[model samples]
Target: MCAFIKVSIATFAVCNRISKVLGFDDYKFIATPVVLLMLSFSIFVTQNTMESHFSISNIWQYYSFPFEAIIPFVVFIVAEIRRKRTKVL
Candidate 1:
């Protein structure tokens, strides 16, 4: 569990850097789908693991992936929204 959490954090950090490098800040809506896909993958795998008697907190533990994905997604959203509002001004 600790390893998984660490890996997830690392993954999110890399995603943050990648989003900045790829200029995803200009595309807020695009990140939504990618985040959803990543979240779905994590949920699916967690569910499969649960069937094998592995302990995964259905509510909180399963939510970790979305929380992880949200960090970068939120950054992009904030940047995009700021850019748009500035343009309108």
Candidate 2:
């Protein structure tokens, strides 16, 4: 229930980008389609095959290592350089 609410509100915020005042009716309008789409996508991705699960995990592992581990160090180095130039610390 909590997860559904969080995801729905996030979907609503992303979809409701128009620069005008909208009320609860507008929210429901956007949220209803988002919820439907989420349900449909869940149905589509529900494969019980172990091969599919293994392939998905392999792809995530391949990408997650360099991006998750190395990118943080690069960001920290860049921030440190900027901080040194400004003498903030």
TM per prediction: 0.30, 0.49
User: What's model 1's overall lDDT?
Assistant: 0.71
Clashes of each: 0, 0
| Candidate 2 regions with alpha-carbon error over 4 angstroms | 1-13, 16-28, 32-51
Residue-level lDDT tens digits of model 1 in 1-89: 99889866766766677678888864445455566777787787667665535454446577687778878899899999999999999
lDDT of 2 by residue, 1-89 (tens): 99989986778675675313544435556666766887797667765667568867787688688999899999999998998989965
Worst 10 residues of 1 by lDDT: 49-58
Can you give the lDDT of residue 86 in candidate 1? 100
lDDT of 1 at 88: 100
